[model samples]
Target: MAKAFASQGDLEEKKTSFTEIGRGLWAFTAEGDPNSGVIIGDDSVMVIEAQATPRLARKVIDEIRKVTDKPITHLVLTHYHAVRVLGASAYGAGQVIMSDKARAMVAERGKEDWESEFARFPRLFQGHESIPGLTWPTTTFSDRMTVYLGKRKVELMHLGRAHTAGDIVAWVPDEGVMFTGDIVEYRSACYCGDGHFADWGRTLDRIAAFAPQSIAPGRGDALVGPDMVAAAIESTRDFVDSTYRPVERVVARGGSLREAWEAVRAACDPKFADYAIYEHCLPFNVARAYDEAQGIDTPRIWTAQRDREMWDALQG
Candidate 1:
């Protein structure tokens, strides 16, 4: 197990908790771990995101078994991050779904992301050998797709670029519940290596317009009720704003990366001190935020080597 960015050490087994959102909707959350949502339709099941590995995903599958015997027919990749997509094969899903842009990212940088994430958090990659390589979506959409889980309607929309160029969300309209990928983490730190800070804010606004009664964020516990949902969105927005804006100002003043990092630390450390993965994410966040602030529209690719070099130079 690798150490968590905050004072807490690496997590072993995630404490799984199943929360019923709607009639057939369930959220599988583990203390601050990546979340996976379940939708049991008329005859089959749809899993929102795959975890880090098959071994880990099996735990989620086990939980699903306790509820229903429906075979998983669809596995949705909210984005192309390795941690969220690698365990996809375990589901044996008849169809793997994602945005077209997400598939493109997998083609471009999937291997690098896999290596980088493995190096960053080995604990999450339990039974790494069981992985059948990178996951690719079998079906993809450009903008939106509507899937019917029996009578329930599940709307998948590419709600603009936020966490990644291919980020999307799954909204259950009749239930007024949304599963926001990494775009809106509840209490967990936002990983911004491939994020677009400004666009993310806009994406949040779009999500807000929906007025979701329940929200299953990328990490942390599921937010129940309207007030908690609103707070979660605001918290995520504040995290992005506080982390990026000051770093941008420093970079614009010709400050060194080290100086800019220090500036961000001083500003964010106090407010987001207890947030999960803050230290692990800050360096990458600052780099991306700085680049975006400098008018870089697209995020640069992140490799394992680059990750370490940047960490040592700026964070060490």
Candidate 2:
């Protein structure tokens, strides 16, 4: 193959930032790596999006300790991607929550995703051996579910799909803050290998309708104000559109996957070339976009071997 995934060579440690987006609500962002959110309530705390492994999760737990010693009683996952869910055991949260559709994906393709991601990016899976196994939710909800950490109410809702079929966001009504898991990224690139391109914009629109004062995105820095929140949502929308539109056009003309890839790069590179994981996500994003444009409703499961074959095809 002419190229391996950009993630394969990403060994540099990202600077992790723990910022307060709202009172008692914090965002743990590692540059452009996966981000997690914290909500400290009257008695306990709730964490959103565990890191890739127990060792990485310890970093978030350490940050939480600095702010409050309250037990993390709930761990709410926004989706079922391996990088977001595998570190779950480290939280020790009695309640692990995910959308019912996400839980089903876990049973169906979770193991394959874990293997594929591990093969693609070893840096995120810092302590792969320590991961207990595929992380399963102790509790699952269909559309929306509310969990209260004492008096604090955190609403987890499936506001349509963008990054994945079961993608959801956590909203804090009092703070007017939302933790959008991969649905809205800041300056970082959206990993759309398992995304729903046609529905992404509508999902983003639903997030904007709430007019969140702040947002803890799936990646990139925490958005602290309404302006930043709005900007991120639109930029993410643009990224999704820019990626899919070119591929859609190519597919309509009966172009090959390689041609679609070239089309996507021509459209997206000038805008997103420098974004985090941009190169790593490009091929997979292009492939999925091609499939979606060709009428594939569900994303095919990605295994380690499939990742290699897909990469090789794109290279040729």
Candidate 3:
């Protein structure tokens, strides 16, 4: 392949910012890179997504230190993806929480995913060696779990499947503030390499039902007002639709993978060419869409070797 994995050329560091979307809810966004959120309550704090490495995670800690002295009592993983969950050891929180399905994913594919992702996006995992190992949750719940940072009520729920089978969204009901992991990226390309297309659209509906006032998506700037929130969700839906529909149409006509890939570029590039990671996500996204549209229910595991093989076949 001419280009590096996904983001190899994306070497310039983004300027990270900590913005307060609600009274005590914060979003740590870095241009269109992966984001992390913070929820502060009367006595303690909860971090929504851990960075790719402990060293990268500490930057979030530094920002946390600037605003509150409260100990980070809880760590939450929105999914089992390495970039989102591998830095759990950095917080030293009392407990780490995730959906039970996410825990199972870790048990089954954690090592492979770790290797696959590290090679795909080297920029995100700057402090690669600082990672202790695959992040293991100290606590796991099924559908919903309600925890309080003193009086503040934060609800964690698995709202169906979008980004991954085990994706979860953190909701602060009191403020209508939401932390949607990779499920609702704004402007940035959604990495649907392991996603459920139709089910993902349904899951987004579940989020829209909440009518959140402010949202901190997995990437891009945090959406603040209700109007902004609505637009973000719509755009996400559009991205999903545009990518899948073309590929599905090609599949329906019994087209080849390369044919579907060409149709995808003609359809998506016009709309998403400027989106972050567009080049990197295109091959994987097309492959998965082709499979799902052809009746493959589960996304195939992406091992490091498989990554190279697929990239070579498509981009070579």
Candidate 4:
């Protein structure tokens, strides 16, 4: 039987959980669904990665109210994927922050991505009508930006291009906890449709330098403690390198796209088969890796039609 395309078959909703990784810091994860984070400081709260809609984001807000009543004053878009950014208005945050490159991506492809992702994952788009429109960051920084929630400080930095061209991670210096958007996925398939394979591995090296005590990845459970943090980073590094390296080798041998895709699926599926979004992401992942292996640097924007065309090209 042919597998369902992207998330079309993902009808079952996941149960969400809030794991407190540090004092006043929490990771909200929903079983491979897009995850979010909350950081409470002395004066206010900062949310990392908004859910897909106001209704979904309210659930995170509800979780926030349980621990701290601090107003959600800051919202950080780790990158401009619609699942991460469209829910911005729900928080009524004073400042919506993103990397300058990310802001440009949003401006350039936000509508297409919004349409593209919505079609891919319908389950994540509950209450989609409530979303006002494309999420625009009120503030954008080139390299790094710091926000002080009283004495606590949260720093946003674009380590390098990995998951997306504009990918960024949130680092809490005092807490020693990092919120890596999609740059790292723990035990979950790395969605490299918009990723830079070589740069991603180099970027992961930069993340390792911080030696975060705990790390919240784009998907999967939070990595608590230094040992777990290191393991997850290495695992993500390995996952990216493993999946793409094999495909790269095949492409260098003048293999067809199908051959490259088969090489990656054969290598990755044995281990990552049960990982979140593995089936949904594999084709796109292979397509991008194939292009990158052939020396494409910037990832092409994905439209709903582009997604289907690639899916059919590989799976038909």
Candidate 3 — which residues are off by over 4 angstroms? none
lDDT of 3 by residue, 116-235 (tens): 999887888888888988999999999999999999999999999888999999999989999999999888998989898989899999999999999999999999999999999999
Instruction: Please give the ranking of all candidate structures by lDDT, highest first, separated by commas.
Output: 2, 3, 4, 1
lDDT of 2 at 41: 94
- Measured over all alpha carbons after superposition, the RMSD of each candidate to the real structure, in angstroms, is 2.2, 1.0, 1.0, 0.9
Candidate 2: which pairs clash?
none
Where's the lowest-lDDT run of ten residues in candidate 1?
1-10
Q: Candidate 1 at 78: error in angstroms?
A: 0.4
True-vs-predicted CA distance for residue 174, candidate 2, Å: 0.6
Task: Look at candidate 3 and tell me the lDDT of residue 7.
Answer: 78
The TM-score of candidate 1 is: 0.96
TM-score of 2: 0.98
Model 4 pairs whose backbones collide: none
Q: Model 1 over residues 1-316: C-alpha lDDT tens digits?
A: 4334322247466688988877778889988888999988888899999999998899889989999998899899999998899999899998899999999999999999998888887788869999989999999999999987677678999989989999999998888999998999977899998999988899999999999999889998888899999999999999999888898888789887777788888888998978877788888998888888888998999998998877777766
What ranges in model 4 sit over 4 Å off? none
| lDDT by candidate, in order shown | 0.89, 0.93, 0.92, 0.91
TM-score of each: 0.96, 0.98, 0.98, 0.98
